[model samples]
Target: MITTVRDYLAAHRRAKDAFPGALLLVVSVFASMAGPSGWHGPRAAPVLWTAAACAPLVWRSRAPVLVTVAVASVEVVHLASAPGQPLVPGASLIALYTLASRLPRRRAWVIGLVVTVALTVALAASRSDEVFAAGTLASFDLLVLSVALGDLTRSRRAHLAALSKRAEQAERTRDDEAARRVTAERVRIARDLHDVVAHHITLVNAQAGVAQHLVRTDAEAAYQALGQLKDNSRAALDELRATVGLLRQDDDVSEPRTPAPTLADLDDLAASFVHTGLPVQVTITGALRPAYPSIELAAYRITQEALTNTAKHAGPGATARVHLDYGDTALRVEITDTGNGVRAADMAATDGHGLIGMRERAAAFGGTLTAGPGRGGGFRVVAELPLPQDPGDAR
Candidate 1:
């Protein structure tokens, strides 16, 4: 019961129009009872007029202009009946304030001036005394004060609403940015896993085939092939573990054991392809220089993916070449294979995510990548990545 009463009181506080009306009613009753000695009117006359004036205030917020006019009209009648009474009552002030708060400044002020003038004239005509008495001036001042206070309240509410809208927009923008970053990170992780698994598994599959073929005729050759297969499997597992480690939560204390691959690891990569019976020749044109870790990683992954494709599609006697050109402004990586293995039409029809991943990686650094048939009847992929102006700025 107490909680119910508290809730009721809270709701009543939020709706304050009734409270003011009740207070004005009580004050008007008391004022009527305490009228001056010269007052010979009926005891109920002033009370009825005051009650009519204050009752309209209940709907002030819903129809502020109508309520203000009704209350002002009633007060004017009451003043005419009893000139010695107050010129403007609390109900009139409340109605005027509601009008000013609800309507625009020009309309509210114009209506307020008209009502003030009408009430002043009524009070002046009823009083055979001074035209502009102190009570009339005070009433005018109170009316102006009510309009000013109401306008201030309206301005303050508008400002707070604008601030709330801006805060909401900023929150939405932040959420969108965070979602974009999360999506980009997921794509990067998936691409890395694909590259690692595809490169190592391709070599392991080839070596397993070789080992199986040599098991009966050449035991020594079979043993070496099996060893290479084991090494390839182990390397694939290591890389898979490293790539998957990126998904760990911030609280995880363990770190990836092996670092990311770079251009320096190209020789080992070429050797692995050679082990699978695909000859890979690596050529560097420009002077070697340090590059950002991200650029190096992208370059290495592109080269690895290109060679993997070459091994899988390039038939017997097909050789691959990796050319790295380090220019002053950009680093270019090109991978080409002899089309004598897979026909140009078959290679063009090949659909896979490797090329897509490479393009994404290059574009991430504001670079460009192109893959098509080379002029020498071979498949070629060229990627050019811009370098920072200062070598020291590379990260």
Candidate 2:
């Protein structure tokens, strides 16, 4: 029941307006019963003056400056007519407080100073100067105190508003950053899909042409080409499914993701290129260490792209060698082919998108990649990826 009443008092505008004025009126009526000795005037006049002073507080918040001026004018008239009388200052105090809380600091302070001086002068003008001297000081103090309290309230409100605005801006920044990252990841996924399909389909197309040409003249050779086509097709499908599954939503519980290809699959990858008529030799030095999934996938994809480019651009019967060196702090991958290096025209034909994708992937894992002509009259691709410290052994 108390909660309900408090809520009603807060929500009801009329109740807020009436409550202070009603209390002041009751106090004024009671103080009037103390007689001329107690109030320094006839009981009826002081009561009427007090009522007049307290009545205007109803609209204090709505027209604070106007209410304050009106209440001050009433107090001056009351002091002039009934000097040294008991005055109810509630309405004027409410008005000044409301004005200070609503207006900007400089303007509110200026107005408060003017009102304080005016109240001091009016209280000092009484015939009994000795009695009203202390009242004058007291009135000035109350005026300043009211304005100070209002300014404090205003400052707190402004502080809260600023904090709320900063929080909203921070939230928006976080959302924008999240959206940008999501867009980058989608583009990365698209590039992977393109590389997977392009490399496999190019080999398939070339093998199919060979198979068709050799079907009558060389039956066994044609069958082998057809078998390679089947294997390439299956591998392409599996990689596609695995890559696409990564795009599934969290709640999509139907299909599970297959593990992505890593450095461990480099041997099988180079062997597959050899089946397509490109001989690739794999050489590894130093002990292998486990790496993060992203780093492993990046290494595999970079190697795949390099070998695919070799098969497509390098002439037939050209030998390619993949060298892996696991250093103390980094992993190095180098793919060199003894064929004509990538010509400017050839790089321009694909707009160098493959190389760009590889660079982006390498940079994503804080790695570096370079591709150009080899020192020994061929093409070479090299990447160095940093190795992170083991979490289990961290101090």
Candidate 3:
């Protein structure tokens, strides 16, 4: 409750503006009684000086320089009128401190020094006997203490402002990073969808056309083509489900039922290609160790994209080979086709999004991918992905 009240008053502009004036008024009342003649006595000159000194304090915080001048002029007049007597200290102290806090450091320091020196000279000229007295020393001490206090307040406010600025900058950086990641993830999902749909749908279209043509003349062949069509459709649906699973929120309980494709699914992948009239030979070298989920998925997608490219460009009577070699430090994948259909010109002219997506996927796992015409005749794709040293790091 107390903290709430303090915060409310701190934000209230009128309350803040009134505080300095009220404090100065109270101080002036006290200083008036300290004169040679008490407040109860008829001392019109001291009362007048006190009023003049404190009156300018109403604008002290708002116009510190103007207030300082007004107060200092009144103090000098009081000193000149009543020699060897000090005017009220509250008005000069308030004005000097307020000026120091509001102004720049260099200017504040200069102002504080000038004010202190001017007051000391005026007081000293009034009484040579009491120039070096304890009262004079106390007066100087008060002026120094006020400037120091104001400088301290200024430093603290500047530090807080700096901290607030850094915090805001950090927040903006975090927001930008999050937006970039979201954009990258959206692009990844679109690529995955394209790979899955393009491969299966192409096979489906071809098989559907074959079944339609052979249904009247060759029933058995048409039935076989129809079976392949159904298989291709199922595969497309399964892949779509798997890829779509990635889009679910973390709290989503109902994710896609189908599991993500991995190296283990390579045989199924090869079988699908065989049914599509392309003979694919998959060779695995070295002991297959458990790999990171992302690496395994990347390897699967790279192979799928390579085979899709082969199906699209390798032409008839072409044979394709997929080699997976697990080295001590990395996993190497190479896919080659022995079809002259994919000419050097075709590979050179290729600037398709599929190749770009494949390269991005490989690069995500600290891997590298190279694709071009094979040494003898067809197309080739080679990818190498670095492996974690510890088996436990596979996740």
Candidate 4:
């Protein structure tokens, strides 16, 4: 109940209930006085002193030191005129506390000490009150303590407010960053979808037309075209689902599709090349672990692109060597095919987008890649993918 009342008063004092009560407090303290000689000595109208003391409270927040001096002066006069009644010590104490808390501690202590000493001396000279009242000094002590407490409270509140504001600002920054990343990712997925869909759609439509044309002439060739179309369409559907569902799925969206090709599947990749009547040797220098999804995908694409180029440019009997070296910091793969040893100018002049895409994949993982002609005789592609610290580090 005491705490509740105090909180209520503090709220009211800051807002509405302070002014009227303050005026009354000033009046009640100075309204009547017993003169210095036990005869209401040197008594003047109490109303003037009341107004003088009350005037300072209005300036409490703006001019703490000046208001304090004014209130102290009025209190000394009242004490001189009447030593009989106990001065209420009301708003003066409040103003004194505000002064101490609002001002620097050293300044408050200096001013408060001066007020105490001067008041004590005046009372002594008047022979009205003693320089040292048995219990009167306690109020002055309370005043000094109030200064320290007020200063401490102000510092604490300011620090907390600063910290809270910084935390809120940081949270807003994180949310904005996340939103930007999401937008970029969505845009990237859209582009990938367009390419993947468009490429396979063209193939499927062309093959379907071939199948329809051959239905009357050679059924075998038509069936072969239809089979290729089925495979192409299914692959496109599965890959699209994997890429698109990444945005919608909650669990393990980072995980690639179940049959997603890894370095382990490089044998199958090699078989495809070997079936094309090329001498393709895949050499694994070290044990290959299941790498991060992104790294694995990059490695696979690099290998596949290199092999496809060998078949297209190196002719049927060209020798190809794919070297996969797993190292401490990164996985290095080199694909060299005897594709008439592309000249520096030729590699530079080759299709623009393939080289750009390959470089993009390498850059995404802070890796490096270089493609040019081998010193012996052929085009060579070298890709180095820096292995991540793994998901455990993230956890």
Among these predictions, the greatest TM-score belongs to 1
lDDT of 2 by residue, 1-395 (tens): 98987798799876776577777777777776765456543367666776787677777777778888988889888878877665546667777888889899999999988987887777777546642567667877888899999898899999999999999999999999999999998989988997898778867877888799899999999999999999899989888988888888889875655578888888888878877778889999987777777787888888888888888888877889999998887889898999887763476476567788888889988899998888987788899987767733311
Off by over 4 Å in 2: 1-63, 131-138, 389-395
Candidate 2's error at 214, in angstroms?
2.5
Model 3 C-alpha lDDT per residue in residues 1-395, reported as the tens digit of each score: 97986787589755664566566666655665664554554345666677778777767778888888888878877787788775546678878888888888888888888888777667766655455777777787888788888888889999999999999999999999999999999998998997898789868876787798899999999999999999899989988987888888889888547777889999998888887778999999987788898899899988998888888788778889999999998999999999874753464466266687788999988889998888888899999998878888997
Q: Return whichever of 1 and 2 wins on TM-score.
A: 1
- Candidate 1, residue 205: the lDDT equals 86
TM-score of 3: 0.87
lDDT of 2: 0.81
The most accurate candidate by lDDT is 1
Q: Relative to the unseen true structure, what is the C-alpha lDDT of residue 231 in candidate 4, on a scale of 0 to 100?
A: 77
Kindly provide the TM-score of model 4 when superposed on the true structure, using C-alpha atoms: 0.66
Candidates' lDDT values, in order? 0.84, 0.81, 0.82, 0.69
Displacement of the residue 277 alpha carbon in candidate 3, Å: 1.4
Answer with 3 or 4, whichever has the higher lDDT.
3
- Cα TM-score per model: 0.88, 0.82, 0.87, 0.66
Kindly indicate the candidate among 1 and 4 with the higher lDDT.
1
Q: lDDT by residue for model 4 over 1-395, one digit each (tens)?
A: 97986777677644333463365554554445444545343334555565667766776767788888988888788767766545545556666667776787688878877876665555454545565774456655665666666677767878899999999999999999999999868755764565455445645665677688888999998887778778777877887887787677566547556465678777866764443346688899875565687788778777776676665567546889899998877899999987787664554466444555567678878999998888888888999998655634311
Q: For model 1, what is the error of residue 120's alpha carbon versus the real structure, in angstroms, after optimal superposition?
A: 3.1
Q: Cα lDDT for residue 229, model 1? A: 93
